[model samples]
Target: MNFISFLLFSALYTCLASRLGDRTLPELSASGITTLITTPDPIKNVDPSNPASHLSKILIPRVSDTENNTIVRDYIVSTLKALQWHVEIDEFTDKTPIGTKRFRNIIATKDPTASRRVILAAHYDSKYSATYPDDQFVGATDSAAPCAMMLDVAEALNPLLDERKKRLDEGLEDDEDVADTTLQLVFFDGEEAFVVWTATDSIYGARHLADKWASTYLSPHGKRRLMGTQSTELTGIEHLILLDLLGAPQPSLRSYFLDTAWLFDALVSVERRLGESGAFAYGEEQGMAPEKWTTYFQPRTELKINMGYIGDDHVPFLERGVPVLHLIADPFPPVWHTLKDDATALDIPTMRRWNLMLRVLMSEYLHLRPEDAQPHSAVRRDASEL
Candidate 1:
């Protein structure tokens, strides 16, 4: 109320804002539907290729922590350790002058010595609260599904790779044991928009990784990558498979077209291979296929990949020139950002099926070669994007 008191308060507020870094949040109302609803092909097959029984069997408790980010970072770390992979918790030490939430990423690596690397990523943090129903927002299917599935796959693959290494030492001629790339599993933080949309409120974790990987790591092709352009900054990256909202009824792979075309192509192949089609047939008959599905037209401008981009941890990597494959649902899934976005919304069987699809694609991408190992398709293909 007094002049001196007002001046002092203003000065303190200015300092806090400066320290917080003027990151603008997106307008929540700006989040809109870009895709036309259409009848999607049904899915049929459901199988777990790796049979990581124990990994799938375990119950991972992920709670919403007010102090911590919504994601259970410790749970992710523990899962990685169980697989025997060396884990690193990359800490983000910056704190706003006023108050700030802690941020970090969990990295699980298998063979650091390998020249090539594969990064499988997912954001662990969920929305702050239910934006819809009168319930707590538990992101069981949105992300917890991806995280858990990746954990199972990692656990199964790590030991398999280790065994192959042993046989090679014995001169057992293990060509199949040869891996084309080292795998890195990163659990990201700060994906949700703080104020719900502007720009700076999204993608904190991925941006950091892009800068580090592009500058510090050498590509398998041995190109001087980021060091070539914007080396002092972050400008180089080739690929990324960012899993989000993967546990819906029959989730479709909808995202920025430029970066996700290859992944999209692969998904079609996987759907056929895994027999996800039958499910879609049922969907069609059940009238679950959206009303305005279009199979041939180019995605609309608003749908112009970037135009419809739902800002998340993936954007930062995309900004750094990483070709990020955002494996997310189309139309932003109705339950998104709502209180209904909880375990009750998850379809266990559907989640299991999607998990199989992911393993199939990742294995294809990994292209592992054992001295006498076998290559098997992870999918049964009967489902598709209607």
Candidate 2:
């Protein structure tokens, strides 16, 4: 992912963002959020110090087409597969400035048969460097951290997703269509440019996948709830939330598109609740205690804001009319594209906060009911406000 001039495409994105509809998601009750935060401990998988943790597994020099890349990709695949997700290794070859290179995009779906899905995506490949020391760049925050967080989210929410499915099976779910929407995690490869950042070089995996899915039509089935006349894989996506440049301290995220502004706000609300509830407080310092924690998201104002989108994997799908919520840090981290972007660059507390936030956010969006370890009495915040 590289930065390009946002002026030329601002109007186009503004139009697309305006045309897309916002989803009104059910907010999790306080107990439900607590259950998600503590059930399995959100920090377990993202801890950089834990050698067997997901983040530690992915923190390697995994440039596209390299052995390290395959190792990281396989780890992601095996982790999701262990949870019984339907995993697809989208392998392909694309011509690059260097030469023809292989790329594999991991597509893991919790329920592939579902008519529609909400996607969480990130590029798993690190930027390639020729020199020995430079070649060691792991891109810890660039995406490794985000990938680990996705795994944590999957592990934390898998049971709740199962429960939602059981409820739908028993006809206890109020909205069958919404209940049918599944969670899909996409780990795109070949996101970095081989040479200079160009239209043909950057985001090779995303471009290929988007074009393929756009043309590949889905066959009709009785279980498909709202199939349009020409329903394709691309069309089946409810939204694509892409994570990039995360896992760093003091990262500032903003709403990049109007279509997903409400969705972004929903995430902000989750963070606020978690922060105020002291869910972010960790370690002996207790740095993220209720009053001490700061927000990662920049609040959206009533005034129309059109900050042109950053050039990333989501650009391909966004161009194809997919609603996107890009959760990338603005003003790229200081260690970005440097050898310093290793395990040390990642802040475990920040990653833990992200893990908790995703668990609560995705849980509520999917209408998942987490079994409360300790029940609390409070009014439900499931009212559709967005």
Candidate 3:
């Protein structure tokens, strides 16, 4: 079978197996199936010395500090640019509890010509902790790890994106349906509050950007244009997958929104297969067992799907009728917002597992063909670069 046909068959088999229980395909090896589906180079080459390596290394204390904030902002922009993505900085000053402070949101896009977009986002700012010393509070798992994972995903998919753009530019395909879906990465600023967590103090960048995008006019291909009578709606956002508190070991992620419950289950399945393949077995660290992981739509007794809401950057987009997949641990990690939330809190095994899971998820989501996975030059960098 051709690569695309093989992928479709695999997806169909997975859905069927998921619905009818693994008993239906009793002889099928879950890990084997996942390996067959994603036939390109796996994530075994993701080394510790790579550019997208440690999350704690990219952590900054707060976005309120101009110098530090610019440092973080430039790092994100340069990283995305290195990955060959179109980068933009949404710079603005907003009124907060501690008066007006400058905030910048880093937006990066692949396949900018595609009208429909799938967003992979994370808040880059560390929370302002009055209890801890200013220099001591580095939000590693709070969001730095998640941000690093997003960048890694973008880098992994760069080959497919470049191929799609090349075909479109050379007029190899005459149909408009051949256009690929865009992947947009957003690094939100000011998700943490200066003093107290209030509506006015938190999620400043998300609120501002959501409103701005909603009011602005864009052509069908996503290029910004003059505003007409009808403004661009939030419907162009196909799915917004927001990751948070992700570096800790063995996190139990549940679906928060009912609409995107399927996506959540797919990720859970990916995690399970990865575990069965011993993908989480990194050195001495024994990650979460397969049984410990949970899915949102499992056949249970009395658990609600959309139980409660955790306020984050996706709220503004969710309020505007955008479907969201929130990948956050229900019970916050042990070192949440504490002095220990530094590099000590991060588990290398857990980060490796997440990295593999996202790579597979994005490849499946975009329906990337095996031939499209072209080998790119290594992103060489020293530890002192960032």
Candidate 4:
């Protein structure tokens, strides 16, 4: 997609979506400084908060501080359980003659019986080192923000789930327009490569899952076409939405067209609609504006994403033919990866709004029954308050 298309699609929201662009997409706000991310409130033990708590996990002092896969897995499992989801720990030993690293993909499902699935995913593992300073960057924005957002959604969605189950049992017909999408929250490890910039180092977890998925649904056939309503204890998969470094001060959610189609459009449309509809930004603590973006992209409208191609966890699902949508944005965000990338750069209001947007979108697309949405909505906090 070209920059113009990105601008135009957004312009469609003449009053709310597009109007902000001209005013918001100015030259620059802050100097592009290399900074480190400060560690914020650590994940403390809260049994009533998340059933995933029963799994025995430790919220590392920092993201990069994660020394091994075990800590990361425990955190994923415990956090999801606290959200009250049946957990599936998918593992693949990357042991090859070239060598292998142990990787695990944590998937906690709140309503697996739902007809279809909508996945909310982000990488929990941190890059081992940084190129800028002696500090090992704690990826609060890169992945943590998205992760925390997912956690927040889990908390708030819990109550939504109960409502869905009741309606379904009462024989609510499809005509009544109930969402039956099963919600899957996945935390991927091995997303960061051993070598920082090497194409291989970037997205190990997503690629591995794609390869495994292709083998599962396509090997029997000539090619894999990621589709179907079929569900499994550990098989059948479909669409996915990937979240990355979105917690920056004012993340510009520029829709990217250079990659997958259905997925990206659905996500961007969901984000904008929710924003304009005010469901995502409801009862704002301070009425924070949408994330401000850079004017580097073309200003047009069409069915395409922004020219910004990102290296994030969504690439794998797209490769697997799952039509994954990526929330990767433009200008790489100022606090991308520097010792200056601390929590100080984080904005709780923006994070909370995004969490609400994701919850609503996931429910809309994934068929996450209103009830299932709740069983996991506790993850969202008052952004303005934070």
The most accurate candidate by TM-score is: 2
Superpose all Cα atoms of candidate 3 onto the true structure and report the RMSD in Å to 1 decimal.
Answer: 9.4
* Least accurate 10 contiguous residues by lDDT in model 1: 30-39
Residue 207 in candidate 3, Cα distance off native in Å: 0.8
| Full candidate order by lDDT, most accurate first | 2, 3, 4, 1
* Local accuracy by lDDT, each model: 0.49, 0.83, 0.66, 0.50
For candidate 4, what is the TM-score?
A: 0.65
Model 2, CA-based lDDT: 0.83
Question: What local lDDT does model 4 show for residue 128?
Answer: 55
- Rank list by TM-score: 2, 3, 4, 1
lDDT of 3 by residue, 164-197 (tens): 6777789874545335457899999888888877
Kindly give the number of clashing pairs for every candidate: 48, 0, 0, 65
Task: Assess candidate 1 and give its TM-score to the true structure.
Answer: 0.64
The C-alpha RMSD in Å for every predicted model, in order, reads 13.7, 6.5, 9.4, 11.5
TM-scores of all predicted structures: 0.64, 0.91, 0.79, 0.65
lDDT of 1 at 288: 24
TM-score of 3: 0.79
Between 3 and 4, whose TM-score is larger? 3
For lDDT, the strongest prediction is 2
